[model samples]
Target chain A: MLKIEGVSKLFNPGTVDEKIALLNANLHMKQGDFVTVIGSNGAGKSTLMNIISGVMKPDAGNIYIEGTEVSQLSEYSRSKWIGRVFQDPMAGTAPRMTIEENLAIAYKRGKPRGFSFGVNSKNRKVFREELSRLGIGLENRMTAKVGLLSGGERQALSLLMATFTRPQILLLDEHTAALDPARAELVTTLTENIVRELNLTTLMVTHNMEQAIRLGNRLIMMDKGKIILQVDEAQKQGLTVERLLGEFERISGKKMADDRVVLG
Target chain B: MLVSLVGAVELGLLYALMALGVYITFRILDFPDLTVDGSFTTGAAIGTVMTIAGSPPWLAVIFAFFGGAVAGTLTGLLHTKGKVNGLLSGIIMMIALYSINLRILGKPNVPLRGEANIFDGASVLTIGLILAVVAKIGLDLFFKTNLGLSLRATGDNSRMIRSFGANTDGTIIMGVALSNALVACSGALIAHSQNAANNSMGIGMIVIGLASVIIGEAIFGAKTIFRATLAVVLGAIIYRVIYALALRVEWLDAQDMKLITAVIIVGALVIPTIRRAIKSKSIAKKRTEEVLSSMGQTSGGGS
Candidate 1:
């Protein structure tokens, strides 16, 4: 379970380009809860994830995961408990490393990394089993360079790498946006299956309203750095795109003009 | 011709050290550290001066390494604390080092005669080559340490590195310091080996270092950190041998040396991409076969 209370982040606070990215944003998720977040451009969706991942500290807020306050912890320290996949497929993993090496780094997320000996039989077996479950036939190509993987394969591999250590929270920031539609679907389905199988708490940020509606048990809509719409399982399940847009218009007093959201 | 070949081998051993330094900053850390140009001169100047002042050759080399490391640390500090771009930081440090190097020797060049080096009247090439191998082994082992991991991770992803509770600034400092230290050490050895050190000798040194790294990566393949470093060392020696071979041709002259080095680097960068293209072509073939097999199974079952 995770709790974020009164978390506000301001970028370039006193500068000419000062923008309040997150204005008293608050989010709470129960254990094993999957939450989907939708927002237009500059909605602070990525900023919220960055706050949780410790990429950026909130200007004013407190974050608690399983009752442990982690707002003060650095990104690396928080990384042990937090797994994340970035929007750019190239950003999530090091390209030059082999599939197993990338997984090895992920596996040792917080642990001290050491000299390369041959990856032992036990570790190899574990990696193989984990890769096999993805059903992507990556187990055989453990030595293959991750750079060679297609966008979809890499994203899936990255997702697996992110969850390999079973972090306390998984953050997916437009993880499949770069992939082709078919590959995106494959990765998203894979994402749902993995989250369910692990019963992991997850926060997925998306531009697609349909994906935002269908994937997670909870749906939250945001605009101008504030969460204007929050829906639970019953409310979210009963919702459609039109109703969500109406709720957004009513709460934020602005029409959602982003074509990404409208067409998606 | 034999004397020239042997001389090239000796120079190659010394150059390997320079390449090692380049590998640390440029290859492993992915930093375009130009401190190498200044640090190399700083090392040679310090070593030559110290040797002329009746210091032991080994001690002089150590002092040179210290000088280079200090210069490297300055560059790292400028980049990390002062928030200077890596290339600019190196350039600034290198420019400052020119004056500092001149001050260290109190002259443009220093000449050494009857000095005690790590090698004596025997085959200097063999002795230097052995030393290069030992240094490479030692560096490979060093990179396996916790601090080394942090340094490497800093190069890989600074954000990811910072989140791990390690200070990226400290890691950069250590990496730059270590890289320049090695380069300066190489300069010291070169000064002693050649019996003279000139302040301007460091010019074009970074190019050679980069050439060695590229050549090594091309020949040995960069499978792991250890192999990568080792390849860099070997590449330095091989690069020298190749250069020596080129100069041995009756048609080539020392004046065209820079042109040859440039050609070598171009070759190093290209070979890897060519290999990748070939490998990917094969992978594509296998992929099509895999798709066909899977498709056949799925269609047969569904039909």
Candidate 2:
């Protein structure tokens, strides 16, 4: 379970270009509840995700994961309870490191990395099994540097790395946005499978309406630094792009601001 | 000639330890730690001062390593906590260490000519070889540890490592500490071998260390940890042999060695960049020609 209490983030507060990224926003999620978030550009979607993962601290507010206040914790400290996949493919994996080496680092997530040898027959076997599950032929090239992998393959690895350790919350920030259509579809399917297999409590940010409706138990729509609407599991089954857009225009009294949200 | 050759190998092996220290901060951590310029002297100062004070020379060597490690730790804190630039942090520590090294030495220089040392009546070459081998093997083993993997990841990608819940600050501090320890130990050994320590003895050490690493990686290739470390050790010896030959050049004074080292490093770094640029340009040209020819056929014209 995860809780965000009245979080507010201000960017360049007193500057001429000051912006209100997030204002008094609050969100809560139950365990194993995969919630897909769709929002226009500058909707503070990434900011919300970053604040939860401790990449950025809120100007005022507290975040609790499994009943522990992680507001004051550094990003690395909060990492114990959070796993993340960034929109940028390069953000989630070390390119110069080998495939197995990256997995070994993830395998010790939320635990103190100690003097034990990083990769052994035991962990290598685990890594091989996990990589094979991705069905990417990665198990055959455990020593190959991650830089050699394609974007889709890398995204799959990122998803696996974020989920395999089984953290309290998994944050995906437009993880498939950078991939081509086929790769994006592949990663989207992979994400659903891994989350279901692990029953992970995942919060994903996206611009894709179809993806938002097609996956996850619940969907939320945001605009202008606020969660304008949230569709529950029961309301989500009947959700369609036209209906959701109509609802957003009816509630906000304005057109959807982003073209990608319309097209995606 | 044979005596000079043996002497060169001995000096090379001794300096190899320092070079390995440089490789850690520079190659593994991707942090250009200028602390080497000061820590090397700090090690020699501690070793020589303690030896003169009648402490066991071996014990002095150990203390010297700690002294350098402390310097490295401060630099790490300055970078991670103080939010200073990595280069500036090392420079600040290197500058501060000059006074610290002087304090440890109690003077500008000290002679350990009559003092007992780890090399007392022992074969210098054998001792140097043993220490270098031990240091190399130790590093290879450390690289296999989980902590080591995180440290390597911190250098390769800090963001990625942080996502895995590893504290990069802790790893960086540990790595810099370990690197300077090796550097200081090498400094102590050099002091014992030379029978003295001077305030300026550590000057340009980063250049020398870098020269060894660059040369080693270029010649032997760093495809694996074991091969990379072995290359560094061999590179140090090769550097010293080249130094000996340079010393034999009547036109170049001993003071020219540092300048020569800087030039060598410049060449090593720039050569690859230039080669890559030319290679890439040629490849781009070839691709353009192929595309242009295909377009020429399809469009019935080439613009």
Candidate 3:
């Protein structure tokens, strides 16, 4: 459902402190393919997602969602087809807005947003029912500001919001990196459940190797902006964290030095 | 004293519009938009000029709103597409607007001789109060809308807003437009009320708007959306009353009006910080006491 061809990204071009983020990276995903991307710090995992989301433009690349070239689209324009959840739980939701209000924005995604009266009773009921599905009792607190929610609750709400309109592609950028272990597991489970239910073509960038193995149907490892190894359905079914790291070392010619990634 | 109080209320009503604008930019969008400095005068200049051109009063006010929106859009473009800092964009626009405002007015000031004002043919205080209520309710309802939710979300967390397939740039543009439109409307009303629009009138207008927002947030405790907006309106009136009353004081120097306004803003902003510090200290003290008491009990049991 999504195709990325020869994507190259360079930060601070022609400056003294310049770095090439992505170098000739290519990715292709089928419909309902949940691809988990694992990479170290500065591995261009987030950059790849950002490019797809239109947060940052690739220096040279052609990105197609359902065969439409979106590399040149602005973040606002690209947003119509892309849904994203960030590493920071606070990044994906407005703190001051109530649950219902945030959901309203999500519901009206890609639609013309002009002046209107207010959230009427009919919309309120729909919002309440939507919130109830999370099993967090958020439906009862529709009027509560999102700031009042805990990290897990907020992330769950964010995931729901990102997939509310069922975009062509969902980009998860370390979405559960900020939560506690128990909360992270809960949110991860929720993520798996939502992706499965919607059958969304998703790119989930994660540092947790275990989650990379456990959650998605396909797993890809990246080093220095290039895809080092990718596992398909048959191989991915029996993949382990240790074998993944072994493959990483063999392909990249370097051991994963980042303790956070190893420990995580 | 009563006359000054009434005049303060009138000023406060006009200021509520600017305060609302500031609330949107500084608080809601988390964008420090300085365009108000120029847009306020731009609105006044354009509205006063339109009135001079024999335009209908209501239409002149509407025109001023659109004028402010145009200026805001320029700032938005500079920030979004041009990747300019919001503050710098606003400042650049403000500088450019000063000249544009002058050109529109054709001079430093333009008098609205016999045109209808917001308070025209009505008791100034009565009309002012009514306008304040209308603006407050009108905006409260708007903020609850889908578009308004997106605007507020644009400031609170832009990433989430974008993920929803909403254009953050479009929201920013709409937000800036909405903010400056309110400010411009204020300028329009003020110009008509005072019967003249002066080039220097918008100086310190942003500070006043900030002061009102700060003061309102402090006084209103920012607990509810309705209360917060209402507090801002109240803060503007209160600030004006205090300013007017200070001017009437025999011992207070009238030249220090700006200084007094500055002090009020500083005081309002600092209150929250001070409260937070005091609360933290008290909590620390209580924790320390509990730890000491626990140690003492353990030693006593050991003995």
Question: How would you class the docking of model 2?
Answer: high
How well does model 1 score by local distance difference test?
0.84
Q: What TM-score should be assigned to candidate 2?
A: 0.95
Q: What does candidate 3's lDDT look like per residue over A1-264, in tens digits?
A: 899999999989899979889999989999999999997778889899888888888899799989999898878777777787888988888888888888888878777777773377887887787777788899889889999999899998988888867888999988888999998888888888888988899999888888889888999888888887889889998888888889888888888755568334
**Residue range B206-245, candidate 3, lDDT tens digits:** 8989999999888876777688889999889899998988
DockQ of 3: 0.68
**Which regions of candidate 3 are displaced past 4 Å?**
A15-18, B112-118, B287-303
Candidate 1 wrong stretches, greater than 4 Å = A11-18, A64-74, A114-122, A262-264, B45-63, B137-170, B215-231, B238-303
In order, the B-chain TM-scores come to 0.92, 0.91, 0.93
Worst 10 residues of 3 chain A by lDDT: A255-264
- TM-score per model over all chains: 0.83, 0.95, 0.92
Docking class of 1: incorrect
* Candidate 3 lDDT: 0.86
Q: What is the DockQ of each candidate?
A: 0.22, 0.83, 0.68
Give the range of the ten consecutive residues with the poorest summed lDDT in model 2 chain A: A255-264
Q: Per-residue alpha-carbon lDDT of model 2 for B24-142, expressed as tens digits?
A: 99999999999999999999998898889989988999999998899899999999899999999999999999998888888897888878988986899999999999999999988
Candidate 3 or 2, higher TM-score: 2
Models sorted by TM-score, best on top: 2, 3, 1
